[model samples]
Target: MKFKFVALVATAVAAQFVAPVASANDQLAQSICAYVADNNKNNLRKTLSDNRLRLKAVYDGISCDGLPLVRFAIKNNAADTAEFIIKQLPGSQVAQSGDIEWANSNGFAASPILEVIKARSAS
Candidate 1:
């Protein structure tokens, strides 16, 4: 009976640790969005590889006004998170556009992401 009780406790503890690891393709994007919103850059980076589809999901999933992931991070006041997201983008992804007019109209023009986007858009 004591052995059985110990096994049950061990299983419950393992379940707690295992719950956050979501690998299903269908749920990956949403999970990444949650991590980004929470400003958990380490988990966000782990959830999104350089894989095209994952990157696209990260691009599309984390947004409040059609903003890119980095913009969302900046808007949420997560500069460290924003930096981590910016490092993930490259090539065509670097040129990926967000809602500049929305940021401008919403008075996010001073945001770090907005500044970076404007600089890139300039030339």
Candidate 2:
């Protein structure tokens, strides 16, 4: 009975520590989404820098309204953010992610960001 109580207490303590970390991550993601939506590149960069996060490192983990970062930017007509994100990503990743194809299929082919993606992929 004592052992079980100790285990339960330990579990509760562990959960208290874990919950804040998860919430922090959620808050960070929300901030990123908001920044992207607003096309506020400076704030976005500041947030990532403050968190010691490289955009490329966290890119795959983030989705804005269920769309990947670049796609989300395109959807929101955040051209500056979209181009910035595309340029930060590796050319191979940009090409292999099929963003160009997705954009064409989704009627985003006219977006100038597509040109940026193509250029980045070529380089």
Candidate 3:
């Protein structure tokens, strides 16, 4: 009985240790989402430095219908933050376009970024 108990405990410990931790990209996405929701530009800027916030994560998080985190910044006309993200993921046309449109439609004109998107689209 003691041996069986030890084996079970060992198995549980191994399973716990082997579980995959949240990737840095995932953490960054969550943080970005939070910052966007809070409309806290300063916190958003700081969160961008996390290595887990990769270009792919940024693109994935901000693209499609738009992630809630970045949606806040886009809606608020946070052009600088949006620009920074564009710079980070230059290849992300969908994210760039979505952000620019969200800003423009929401009364936060980001013409310069829009111009860039247009130029890229033209090419």
Candidate 4:
């Protein structure tokens, strides 16, 4: 939780620089990332749906903490949101597994997000 807070703050800080240098793709990514960070499920879904043709950009835009949108959904307890993203981006299962390694190395191995990732991958 503390890490999530810190990540959000860092995202806010980084957003300042990111806004100026961001290309159209980066801007789109940033917007989606912001929605995920804020747990704005409705906006995120709309944004994602609107940019369905730009799936690569959506996948590239990670949260301020470098977390994928699915992890954000897990942290926010937004199971439906997570499910939607998981279905939309099946390749993220590999990324989620990588996050588990990162969490273990970074001392957050007990995170519920990891459990959710594990459960999803098991299915």
Q: Write the number of the candidate with greater TM-score, choosing between 2 and 3.
A: 2
Instruction: Go through the candidates in order and give each one's C-alpha lDDT.
Output: 0.63, 0.90, 0.56, 0.64
Candidate ranking under TM-score, highest first, comes to: 2, 4, 1, 3
Q: What is candidate 4's CA lDDT for residue 49?
A: 79
- TM-score of each candidate structure, all chains considered together: 0.53, 0.95, 0.49, 0.55
lDDT of 1 by residue, 1-123 (tens): 999999999999988867766445436666766776788887777666543445544565555445556666666866666656655555355454554666677777777766555554554
- State candidate 3's TM-score: 0.49
| Candidate 2 ranges with C-alpha deviation above 4 Å | none
lDDT of 2 by residue, 7-121 (tens): 9999999999999999999999999999999988889989998999999999999998998998888878888888888888998999898888988899898988888888999
**Candidate closest to the true structure, highest TM-score:** 2
Query: What is the per-residue lDDT of model 4 for residues 1-123, given as tens digits with 9 covering 90 to 100?
Result: 999999999999999877776676677777876776666767877886786654445464466456766655555555555555655655555455476676577676666666666665666
Task: Give candidate 2's root-mean-square deviation (CA, Å).
Answer: 0.9
Please identify which of the two predictions, 1 or 3, would achieve the higher lDDT against the true structure. 1
Pitting candidate 1 against candidate 4, the one with the higher lDDT is 4
Candidate 2's TM-score reads 0.95
After superposition, which runs of candidate 1 have C-alpha atoms over 4 Å from their true positions?
Answer: 1-23, 49-68, 91-96, 118-123
What's the alpha carbon RMSD for model 4?
Answer: 13.6
Sorting all predicted structures by lDDT, with the top scorer first, yields 2, 4, 1, 3
Which of candidates 1 and 2 is the stronger one according to lDDT?
2
